[model samples]
Target: MSDASLNPTATDRWMLPEGIEEVLPPGAWQLESLRRRLLDVYQRWGYQLIVPPLAEFLDSLLTGVGHDLDLKTFKLTDQLSGKMMGIRADMTPQAARIDARQPGNGIRRYCYIGSTLLTRPKGVNGSRAPVQVGCELFGSDALAADAEVVCLMLHSLEACGVPATHLELGHMGVYRALLARTGISEAETVALFEALKRRSIPDVDHLSASLPENERELIRALPRLSGGLDVIGKARALLDHADLTAALDALEQVAQCVQKDFPDVDIHIDLGELRGYTYHTGLTFSAYRSGMGSALAHGGRYDGVGASFGRPRPATGFSLDLRALLPLIQAQATPPLAVLAPAEGGEALEAAIRELRRTRPVIRRMPGDALEDYSDSCDAMLTCKDGVWRPEPFSNRS
Candidate 1:
């Protein structure tokens, strides 16, 4: 063969950019089925479904969490408005916007399922474009709101077939309260938050060195306060500021409610976990399971996220990557059924095909085509017998 024939052209390569993936065949079906089931459950729970545009003005998209979201979002200049726009990196903020618009003093529940694009991959196995499915509860400051959101997060995982999951709970309020009492600079607090989030003891100690002995000790101790139920007691004893006390109490209340409702769920506490530090106001939690390195779902309370939209409301919610959870799900296989029809058939055969499709997936085979052409896709074939078309199992016995 000539060199031209051997070498692959750009189009011939047919390669996708890194971090993007296409779901084919049965995998696509599985993801869609899981999405439908999740939305169905959310609907039953009174979460009205909302579909936000994939892109929005950067100002609205970034809203309160601009610092955290800027790096992850994809920006573009809108042709229509000549203004900056962003493809969403996360959908939680959009859900918050929708909730802000609802006219009610009572709680509003909203759920959404859509694709979010990121500028970079979240982790080694993470996808840049993830199908983000989540629900948000608005207008409640009660601890019960936090518990309900956490419970819904756990149930979502269970519905997706995650096994032996454990919830790691934390309160950003604890750490935030400590920072407030320290009277630290904004830059210093940001540095401390990063250190505690990574659980870097050396960094935490270095940053807190300039503070007073009591303040320094408390700052250093934040990252180490993590464990089971006992961690709450440790937090209460180690931190004594009024805000800190309130935070610990709120966390304990949420823990009690979650434990009472979900007895089987293994719960662990990490007082240092500042996952959504910039955005989360109070309690935060993440659910992790065996065989997965990352949390299956995560969310927390962000009390003032909707302020920019002109209607501030306390909100709590969780989101999971639907495509990521597909492998963990033990779903049944769906095979296509092929119905063979004559090249020139009457309207009766067409009617029969439609009827069969109602119960099971049915595909029509053209006349004079070899059965082998339909062998791979068709699990069963329909043939006319006694003047009526009946489905007969098609087994490719080669």
Candidate 2:
């Protein structure tokens, strides 16, 4: 229907759209291997794997807690039903739908690894499509659920070969409780939230200027509350309200539990840092390494996401982009010893090829395909010597 489709040129054939990429050679291999390993790790932790449809009704995709995801989603009209549909920008809401549909009231843990499409790139030179790998826990309000997910996230990073990572923890309850006490209107609260997210102290001062000086000082103090665990003490000293005090107590409890469980991970607290303020109800956290500008993986306790699906359950989870993680992973290039067998080989060579494949990979040499075709893929070649087929290094082949 289009001119480019009818008569494609060399430029069309070779080029790809910006923010999209193809994982070639070793990168593809590493992605697949990492995906499998992470999924396996999640399964061992009692999380069942589920695959939700890639595209669904727009309303269904946007149902609960997706204001951020909504802007990133790609939308289209379904021809058969003539209804709006959306490609998922994140899979957490879908996982929530699945959990809500489950038969009983017992706890449910779900894990998923799949590709998600976004309208915009997540970071500098990021892909529009990222392989999302994550797990969600539902039906538990205990701090242990938050602790479990955080520990699992740490194990996940360790499994992916990330080195010497740190954890930054925050509780949206702190800010939400403080805001509720301020008695500010919704519009002003949202404006203040955006400013705080940007860590713009001047804008916070400008926006909260109308509030009473006491309320304004508390709002202004939020962005300054980032550091090691002692920051919690400062937060408690600054806020005296009973509900706000309770929220700080919850933060202290969760942070202590996580520290006890994982003593090696360095923990930082940001009482004012409300990353998922609208959705996340309680303890929120993200993992970081040395060079990444953004978090490696992030999630938090979103207690009411299931309410939109007719079931209100406590939920928390985290997701990481597998494609983005490939660069962060300190992977050792242990390329498999692939044996290339000639097409003309008889049943003996075929049998040998099958047997070798069981131990290592085997690349079949197709008819009319040159040796160079298999050069980079295989390090060794199968040869016949005195009626016995054997594999020798490609460099040593005569």
The lDDT, on a scale of 0 to 1, for candidate 2 is 0.86
Off by over 4 Å in 1: 1-13, 330-351, 384-388
Model 2 — which ten-residue stretch has the worst lDDT?
328-337
Write down the TM-score of every candidate: 0.90, 0.92
* lDDT values, one for every candidate: 0.84, 0.86
TM-score of 2: 0.92
The backbone clash count of each candidate, in order, is 0, 0
lDDT of 2 at 256: 82
For model 1, residues 1-398, the per-residue Cα lDDT tens digits are 88867997988688788999998876787788889889988988899999999999999899888686899999999999999999999999998888887787789999999999999998986799999999999999989899999988888877766743688888888877777778988898888888888899999999999998998998888778888989888888888888888888888888888888688778898988888788899889899886667888889999989899888888889898998887665353443445554454577778888898777777665656787877666766777788888877776523
Q: Residue-wise lDDT of candidate 2 within 244-351, one digit each (tens)?
A: 787778778877887786788888898877877878988898999876668888999999898888999989999888898887552555556588888877999988
Instruction: List all candidate RMSDs to the true structure.
Output: 3.3, 2.6
- Per-residue lDDT, model 1, residue 139, is 92
Q: Which runs in model 2 stand beyond 4 Å of their true positions?
A: 1-8, 330-334, 396-398
